[model samples]
Target chain A: MTQTSKKPAAVEALGLTKIYGSGNTEVIAMKEVSLSLARGEVVALLGPSGAGKSTFLTAIGLINPPTAGRIVIGGEAVMDGPRALVDLRAFRRRHLGFVFQKANLIPFLKAVENVAIAMEINDVSPRAARKRALELLDYLGVGDRARNLPDALSGGQQQRVAVARALANQPSLILADEPTAALDSHRGRQVMELFRQVAHEHGSAVIVVTHDHRSLDVFDRTYEMEDGELGAKHSPPAPTANSTPSA
Target chain B: MNLAAKDIRHNLGRFVLTAIGIGLLLMTVLGMSGIYRGMVDDAMVVVDRIGADLWVVQHDTRGPFAEISRVPANLEHRVRAVPGVASARSFVSHNVQREHRDEPLRMNVHGLAWPEDNGAWVTLTAGRPLGQAHYELIADASLGLALGEKLKLGKDTYTVVGIAKGMVSSGGDGLAFFTTQDALAIQVDLPGDALRLERAARVQRAVAQDLGQVQPLLLERGAGMASGIPALGPPMVSAITVRVAEGVDAAQVAATIAAWPDVSVHTRDDQEALLVRGMIDKARRQIGLFRVLLVVISTIIMALILYTLTLDKIHDIAMLKLMGARNPMIAGLILQQALLLGALGYGIAWVLGGWVFPRFPRRVLITSEDLWALAVVVAIISVFASLLGIWKAMRVEPNKVLA
Candidate 1:
């Protein structure tokens, strides 16, 4: 799992390092972190608080640039040591999707609008974007809640809508930061299984930063992080019935 | 779908209330301009109605309106003998205050030369122009005088023969028109005891002079004749209003009259300029300052409102940025909201003005040009006010969403 894929990897980060301040105030957030993920795979990142998991995730997400690193997505070198080879904002818009713990759906927009806007900003036609958004919501089992606002939806339903929004642009990489932290055990496992299903079926790579270990078996591989360094990966457990939705 | 429109729909109550608040402010700004127009219009009302080609006043004076001007009553005869003169009539004006029906009544009295000037040019809303040489007057409707109403001024009771509309002096007092003889009578009328005191004083003054000492019998004859009798041929008038021949240039006629050292000559345009610029210059400046101050206050208020609204949406803004929304798109949201607010407020101001302006003590005249200019100014203000909100939105860090 540590070796690079023969087929083009969906995400490849080489010796990524992030440093904050210098001299007396110098602090290193992440040190020489390398990660690779094949297409159609879901990976779990587990860590204690302030262990640099978020720093590493943000670096790969192109939101926060690493001080020294090479980031390649879909076989193209996008970021080189805090310098961007392409327009980072446009690249992020067209190729990456993000889901936060709070769902982060625009409060004023309905569920379908929230998802459709993600694709529309990428220059997709409104009608096609809406149609794709509805289809994604249906695939995630939140089709009936398409007209509801974020506040009107339950915790599990809101997370499902968020997932549908992340899949709106058919992105190559999906990054989720503790997406299930606000949900109960039953709802949290349901969200984690949805990520696995999204990766396996849509041929996109998925990485979830989570503290919950009860649903780690849903991922294809797991990596524990501490002291700003990523540990060795662990093999996934056998398929369990709990991975499937109860309802 | 328009993001700004959707947000407004989401919070329609707050948006509408905000627009109403802005509308009242805009109304005050618009009213300042209206009041300025009203002042200018009011100051020129009498000057316009007279329709004189040239005005002959006391030498070196701007008046009959801007300053007090008095010339000999027979100046019209001299002005008529000038080349290109069509007709000239004596005019006299003064302000009178007295009690009528237990309420204090104030009017600017204009005396028209009888036979030669019947006040036919005055626009009448009711009743006919002066039909008699005495005891008949035309009063502006602003004075609350009705047609055929008898008003007692001095010892004579004058009948309201006509009613005029929008006829007011530069000071906003309603105008009343009467024949020169009747107006002079009202000026000279006095109480019996005061008349006796004046005659005794006139006799004493004559006795002090050599003529009175040599002819005491002549002084006694003059005292018995009338109170303060001077035996002058006629009373002096305020000015002479001249109408030149149709084909004759008024300025040339005015220049001819100006050559006479006894009186100053002003063409109709010059008279209007003097009334507007010299009479109401301070009022104009005061209104202009108020208009500018209101616009500045409106801009600041709008900026603060927009800034507060932007703060309310910081979380949403950060989320949009993370979702890859462009800076222009985000900025457009704030700009559209500001413009909508301005448009709504402007509309409400017009509606409010329509209901309220007619009731004002002074006239409020609104021109189409003024309306269009205000609209353009409001649009510009909206854009400027949105800048503060746009700056705040641009500084939002997308990484904040993850935290």
Candidate 2:
């Protein structure tokens, strides 16, 4: 039963450290944080303000490089410290997905086009890509707003379209930062459940940075961060004052 | 998706306003070139109308337009007698002004040595040409002269006998043709004050000789010298235009006459060059400088607009970079938008130039070849202008999206 339950890890980081500036003004944003996430698992990262949550998210997302670390994604070793082992841009496009605090949809494009362009950049055929985009939107329950621009959609609907975009390439790992911060409690909890469903249904690993404690129960595992350090696993942990909880 | 096009459509009003501003500048650039072309045409039309193979004038002078030239009217016979010289005619040209209903009308006076068949030069659109009378005149239609209207030239009245079309002078003024004899009378004939003074002096000298106040033989000699042989003021003809016979080279004949230090002879090409290059040189330079100024102004405006537009969308550019968009792709977006702006501006200028040019007092001429050449120049300019925006875009940090 234990052998059957074991799954390959999607992301692995060893001794990840991120330092900013130098000399007297220097400060460590993330400190020797080692973490691992497995396929079909959804994890939540909760932190106080300046708790290094964004630093960890960006480092693993391949945007900002870590000061010292060994990082791997989808069984491929990609980085050593700040140096990249492969072309980072191609690596990110093929293996990783990211969602920001806001939907950040391209204003000029409709929801379907916004979703499809993410695939198009990967050299996917426009017709096939658009068909897949429609399917993803339907799966995310925003198919009715496929032709509407981001400005025309509600906050939750926009986030759904953004999630559809993030999933267009079927990436092995997803990193989201405050994906439901702008939504109401009902919508935020719904978005959190959607992330949980995405991780389980696609057999993908997901890491979400959030302060919404009400939805923390939806995650498979929860980690808390403070003063640039990750705390122990929690049956439950109260959010700090620096953390902004919607409800 | 064509990101640049979608953005432009999203901001259609701002894009249109920018295009209009650039289009007006392009229109002025095109119009200046057209005006230069028109001026060249105006300068050559009179010489072309003469249809003479050679132009003979005073030594070291370009002739009627570039400098004052005085060649004797009798020289026409000698030029006609030259080998290969088919025929020759004396021509007097000058700028004159006459009053009509209290408005001063400026015109060019062409003194034609009459009794020749050169009447075929002018294409009459109304009325008949001059009779043998000295006061009869053939006028250019642009002069707005009606048939039988009287024009006062120096103390003489001329009736407009015919109207000719497009017969303007080198300076773009309307033309009037008269007999050389009549033109000499109008230009060099003594003014009323001088004529009266001369008569009074002659009367006083005659009375002195009659009263034995002076020697009669000396008086007779002086009177014979000043005799009624009609006192002449200045030479009548400004130049002589000569035609060459069939099977003869005009240059060969011009070289033959050029041997005489007292005269300078020129072939058709020499005259055209003198008028187009020498006469229109300064005007061309002025128009060329103005055109260059307009191009520079347009380039600067385009670059500024592109930079501003790029700044406004810096967030979007950063997102694209984060999504794995390459440098070429971002640069291409900026470059493509600049090119579209140039193309739209050019099209607008072409239409506007055609509609506005004719109403100008001076002639304006544009050709398709000029338009194609300008299009190439404009395309190059757009590419260079987009570089500013591309550089700004390339500097966008993909990591900015995280913050």
- Top candidate by TM-score: 1
Candidate lDDT values, in order: 0.87, 0.83
Q: Give the per-residue lDDT of model 1 (tens digit) for A1-247.
A: 1334455689999999999999999889988888888888889999999888999999999989999989999888999999998888788887888988999888889999999999888888999989999999999999999999898999899989999999888889999999999999989999998998888888889999999888988998889888888887878877677777332
lDDT of 1 by residue, B262-365 (tens): 88988888889987888888888988898889888888888899899888888888888887899999999999999999999899888898788888877788
State the lDDT of candidate 2 residue by residue for B1-403, as single tens digits: 7888988987889988998888888989899898888888878877888888998999999987788998878888889889999989988888888688788898888877786843556889988766774888899887889998998878888888889887777677888888888877777756777776666676567667654355455434434423342443335488999989999987789899999888998877888998878888889999999998988888998899988988887888887777777778789889989999999889888988889988877778787877987798789878888989999999998787765
CAPRI docking class of candidate 1: medium
- Clash tally for model 1: 0
Separate clash counts for every candidate: 0, 0
Q: How does candidate 2 score on lDDT?
A: 0.83
Off by over 4 Å in 1: A1-7, A245-247, B184-194, B221-233
Give the candidate number with the greatest DockQ.
1
